[model samples]
Target: MRVAALDDDVDQLELTKYTLQAVGHDCHVFQDGDSLLRELRRESYDLLVLDWSLPDMSGPEIVQWIRDNLTERIPILFLTNRREERDIVEGLSCGADDFMIKPMRVGELVARVQALLRRVYAEPLPTEQVWGRYKFMPIGRRLEIDGKAVSLTQKEFDIALFLFRNKGRLLSRRHLLESLWGSSNPPGTELMSRSLDTHISRIRSVLNLRPENGYRLSAVYGQGYRLESIGNEDYEADAQLAQSQA
Candidate 1:
């Protein structure tokens, strides 16, 4: 998962980044609210770790800005020095999903982060998952559409599954690469770009992702990709056809 953290204290920022990276997450740190907000405009993160006090803007203010502007419900966790009960209440009320008082313990931080991710992403990934006409068997890394199999490379399966799991969300290219590669600094070379595009194209072709099929896999110009369900019209047609067959 991709995480963005904000903290004015340089040492704390580094520690937080290291902690998240150690647990297989790509972490990006910002020293001020402005830079973090700017990145949020172009990039999409799975979660956010924020400090209550900052050089420019308060964490709560940033949270409010995100809730007001962003359509995606990205999870936000507050790791701050303020330990007051009122502070906790205010943080949650302002839109943070979780709060932890610091001088942070590494173990506690990891646990909190994992718990937040699981709750937000619906983790403990099931062996078999289905969406509309497509069914995924993660253990075997196999995908099926209407009971017929679709061949995919391991990398292609990973990318396709990630996009399906995060359907309706605009995932930035960097986020997709980091999630697949598990590298904080994913190679942004032209070769890597072409590889990703090729994989997406292949998945679309194999899955027959079209509106009549009840799904659409599309590229978001300079952003990345989003898999979305068109509407219930197609779903209704499929149900009627299935009923007629029955």
Candidate 2:
């Protein structure tokens, strides 16, 4: 899992990074809330380790920004020097999932992070996942849409499953590229964007994913993409509205 650790103290930031990395997790350290927020907007993280006192902004303010802007409810753990009960309450109320008063024991911090991850993303991953009229058999690398088998490349299948697993969340382009292409860099060239767009189009067409079909795969302007499930009645109403506009 990718994690972001924020602390104004350089030494503490380094220590946190080392401890998290030692446990086989990719951890990035940030020195200020602004930088962390910038990266958060560009990439998706599984968890965040934040300090209450920052040079730029308070931890609660950062948590509020995350809750307001991010589509996914990423778990956050506060590692701070503030030990007052009020501080803990405020942090939790501001949307942090967990809190730890500093100076923290590295081992306990790691355990707390693990607990939060488990609590937030604990759904058992099965060999197969079924949605509405679609069945995805990961073990067999097969997909059936409304009783009809549709051929898809391995990459296409992986992308489809990723989108489905994170349906209703706006995934940044960099996040998709990293998950699919193994790179964190955003697509820069026309060819890169076209490649991703082509795969998305193919997946939508093969799955018959449209608002009228109770599923919508849409691009989020400057962001990336979001796949959502809608009720049949809502889809029909949207179709009618679109027809009226046309």
Candidate 3:
């Protein structure tokens, strides 16, 4: 994934860039939110890592703007020092998918960025995904689970398709906002978030799955929503360890 970092702290920004690159992702850097926003207008990136505090706009505010004004959905990660409960919630409420408290370990940040990218962009296609007992054809995008065919809204279908493809990646809320809502007029917090939630609710209702453990969509506390199987190396290590224990 092509990831961008926006921070006033040059040292941290470079460290983030280097760490992500070492882990096989392309990265870019900006010292402030405004410059990053300008760059957003000119290019496309799979992900953005921003600081919560900036000279121009807070990362949360910038994310809202991207949702409203831009034509694309770019996953946003806030690499800020703000760890107040309300502050983190505000970031997610404003459309940020993942929030990283500043002075974060490099490995942890890289893993998280990868997790979001996998969730939002690199989800694997399902051999077959059934929604409400309706099995879907991946290639043809047709639904037929119970012998009877079921219809879906266009966005609903897209949601199903995306979920089916990437069953295990955790996607951040800000990232989902971009993926589902796209950037238009650099959206305000209210518009983008409400629109995203609406889309999610619409999808959930159509599938008729219990909200408690709805289909593939699961919440990852302190990060974002993830498909059932998405995670990092530690997750892999745990799996290996489990096998050893077994």
Candidate 4:
């Protein structure tokens, strides 16, 4: 699982990062909440291991942002030194999936995170596939969007999973092609950039939100495309964003 560890404490970040790495989990550490937020905009992780206190923002506040911004449900694990009753209540109320006390236990942490992932994401039956707001029939690879079944081209389905799995990173046509299909595939394969554009068009069509509909697939001008999901439609709606322009 890809995990992000945020803490103002350098030693703690290193310790936790080492532990997570030792267990074969990918981890990214942040020195402060603001930096983490910047990175958060560019990358999404399966689990967030956040320190309860930071100089700029508290862990609970970050958790709330994850719930609001990410279209996919991500597990948040609160790592805090505070053991007070109010602390625990506040963290849980703020959308933390689990709590881990800070002196650190690597094995227990990995086990708990694995268990939470299983409970939250595991499919119930052999023929079922559930991802975000879509469903798939495992046996037939049939996809349903918002309860209505939609026909997806094979490349479209692959592109969908690639987008879902790498929710945060901007993927260029080159990076995308490399990741989806390696050098072995012909240069003019079915998964070319125009093909990617076509797949994205088809996906948007199924959702009833076209590129012209204010729903977006962010074009990074010379770099690549990054999905900007419209779960609560916050693409440019922050009061702070407005005040900055003023």
Best by TM-score: 1
Which of the two candidates, 2 or 4, achieves a greater TM-score against the reference? Answer: 2
lDDT (tens digit, per residue) of candidate 1 on 1-246:
889999999999999999999988889999999999999887899999999999899999999999999888999999999999999999999999999999989999999999999999977367988987888999989998889998899999889889888989999888887788776576665677788888999888888887767788889888888899977786677678878999
Rank order by TM-score, top first? 1, 2, 4, 3
Candidate 1, TM-score vs. the true structure? 0.90
Residue-level lDDT of model 4, residues 114-158, one tens digit each, is 887777654346766565566766466577877888887676776
Comparison by TM-score, 3 against 4, better one:
4
Model 1, which residues run further than 4 Å from truth?
Answer: 124-126, 233-246
TM-score of 3: 0.51
Better of 1 and 4 by TM-score: 1
Residue 11's C-alpha lDDT in candidate 3? Answer: 88
Who is ahead in TM-score, 2 or 3? 2
After superposing candidate 3 on the true structure, give the runs of residues whose Cα lies further than 4 Å from its correct spot. Answer: 124-246
Query: What 10-residue stretch in candidate 4 is worst by lDDT?
Result: 207-216
Candidate 2, 69-152: lDDT as tens digits: 987899999999999999999999999999998887999988998888888764536787888898888986789888788899
TM-score of each: 0.90, 0.86, 0.51, 0.56
| lDDT of each candidate versus the true structure | 0.90, 0.86, 0.70, 0.71
Kindly state the number of residue pairs that clash in model 2.
0
